[model samples]
Target: MPVKITLAQAMGTCFGVQDAIDMALDPIYRGKLTVVGQLVHNPQVTERLLANGVRIVERDQIDSITTEAVMITAHGASDSTKADLQKRGFTVYDATCPLVIRLHKLARFLEREGWFPVIVGKADHVEVKGVVGNLKASAVVYHERDLEQLRGHERLGVVSQTTNRLDKVNTILDAMRKLPWVREVRFIDTVCQPVKERQAAIATLLEADIDLGIVVGGRNSANTAKLREVIADRGIAAFHVERPEEVEPRWFVTRRHVGITAGTSTPQDVIEAVYQRVREIVAQPAAADHA
Candidate 1:
């Protein structure tokens, strides 16, 4: 029998990521540009940019930048951070996704409304850090257990990382809504549309007869990790891999149906490569013997 490989309809690079790369590699800023952080979460994308002459600098190393132009990655930054970079004389090119800008605005609005902004995401994630920094969040939580650190507030607002899986964020939001002392729980939806679609696509695939799933993206990609986490939590076998070479024959030996999902930062070509690789692996004569 032939192996069936299913690719998520919404998988791979988002508009924001392509725009960032375009601006970074544009002739206007070529060789003279430096991104304050990784242009996107995918290492392949960043490596391509770096090989093409884009320079990367950590946020703390802004003052050390010798370039005349700096690009703010798709992940975004606080208004204050942008101002500080401009103050130092670098021509700042903001490649922040418009959606992320809107998300930030929402967080700020929640804060101004006297709602304690509770971020549902990894505290160390670049997107989460920017959101928290912009909103001046006192604390952020990814799970119900982390809520113990949050004090009882009359009104609480929750926002999630743009690339986070909605199922995970919804789980956290559900827990927040059930909190006893929280009179009003404002669950703001900051998860990006593409991310949500990809996650939903994954869920649809997981519901099928697939023996396991493959999530393609950088290991450092927060959204990819969350998708993998959610899929595994559903009792499905899933692997988050960055490249085609990472695929193992063992993962598909007994599996006839394979589900493929990619993070927003993952490039389309990478997804294709993984898809083809899986098909090739399962075509081996002995592949289904273990099934």
Candidate 2:
């Protein structure tokens, strides 16, 4: 009588996350290793790295440490960060997603061609920071109101943070066209496909007859938060939990069918554990009711 649990086919870690982990574990002669930020924004993944003896250091602490190698997260880092690390005598390990790196390169190329670069993403995000860092003159616009800050720009080039919502990027592009001075606006659709696919897949899952939704990922993970938002938008009960222990019994009280989804950064094992926990939670009441 255990509650039925269905996991999204596209759930769990993407290629970028997988690549970052492999790079971190590769045996290289990095005198001392330091990671710029939460490598994949998953505590369990971070803990695994810690167990493997990788040091996760803060941005400010990077300069003070004498590590021979410093890894930029999958989210990527600004050019300034890489320069600073090198200046501090650290060998840089670029673990940035290839898609993000491609966007950075595109921004630099457009800047050289006399196009004012504009990034459609969270200004504070590491990936956006890296993209902006490559630009000599650029603007970061997260909303329609922020577009008003643009000045005297006829020719503009746009790129987005790889993790940004695709619809928001399109809306921002539409808004940018309304600017009077904008003569030509070229947009590079750089939002990562894996991230978009996961999001779209979750949206499709939500349309089905599901009782409750469980989203798994780190609290600080932006993409993970977006997945939770999508589920909550359906007005169904949804919980964002990082681990199996966070699942509550009450969530299953009236739920005969539960849906499970994980962020791009989440590992497969974590998702499985969450599913097993959900099954156990749903089974308890049915067992008691029968008794």
Candidate 3:
């Protein structure tokens, strides 16, 4: 049987991520640069920066960085973090996605309006942490169980991580509104447009009769993980791989029709490589074994 591959209409790296990568690889900052975190959540991007003499330091390890110049990742940093770095005599370069910066402003604006800010996102995510760092009080919730912390607040202002799934965010928001103690629920749509487009594209792709789905991106990418979750939720066999080598030949044995997608941070070359690998694997007659 011949294998047919379908690519999603919208996928791969977004503009904000590309802008950050360009800044990281800029010749002027090449030798003196230290990125405060994984610049865009892709290992390939990280490797490229390292090869070009850029240094990467974790958030807590900023004090250990010896570089005179530092860059905040596309995920962004709190105003205080940037101020402290400047106070420490380091030249700060901001590569925060414009959308994420909007989220920060909206969240802060909500806080200032006498609304208890509630972020619908992972508590430990770098972007979430950055937003929370700017606010004195806020609740981060991803599930119905996390809504307990919002019980006592009179008015709740909600915003989501830019890359969060819209469906999941809506679910959490609906749950928040159901809580008896909550009075006013004000919400802003903060999820990035790229993420929503990708999600919508994946939904459209899945409408086809695909035997399985392949999602390419960093293992830690929240948006990439959500794409896989969407595929799985539709009962399709979903394989999430960061690189071409992770694509298993055996998985395609009986699956003749494959749907492909990539995360916002995934590089185009990486996505193409994965797609080509799948083609190569399915070309082998023995690769079609049911085992």
Q: lDDT of all predictions, in order shown? A: 0.83, 0.84, 0.92
How would you encode candidate 1's per-residue C-alpha lDDT over 1-291 as one tens digit per residue? 677888777888889888888888787777899999888889888888888788998898887788898989998988888889899998888999999898888888989988998888788877778887786655789878998777567588778778777777788877777778778888888888887788778778877767788999999887788778877887889999999999988887656788888888899889989998887788884854553
* Error of model 2, residue 228, in angstroms: 0.9
User: Candidate 3 residues 1-291, lDDT tens each?
Assistant: 788899999999999999999999999987899999899888998899999999999988988999999999899989999999999999999999999999999999999999999999999999999999999899999989998888789799999999988888888888888899988999999999999999999988878888899999999988999999999998889999999999988888778689999999999999999999988888885855743
Candidate 1 worst ten-residue window by lDDT: 282-291
Give the TM-score (vs. native) of candidate 3. 0.97
State TM-scores per candidate: 0.93, 0.91, 0.97
Error of 2 at 132 (Å): 0.8
Model 2 TM-score, all chains together: 0.91
For residues 106-168, could you state the per-residue lDDT of candidate 2 as single tens digits?
888888888899998888887887788777789999899998778788988888878888887
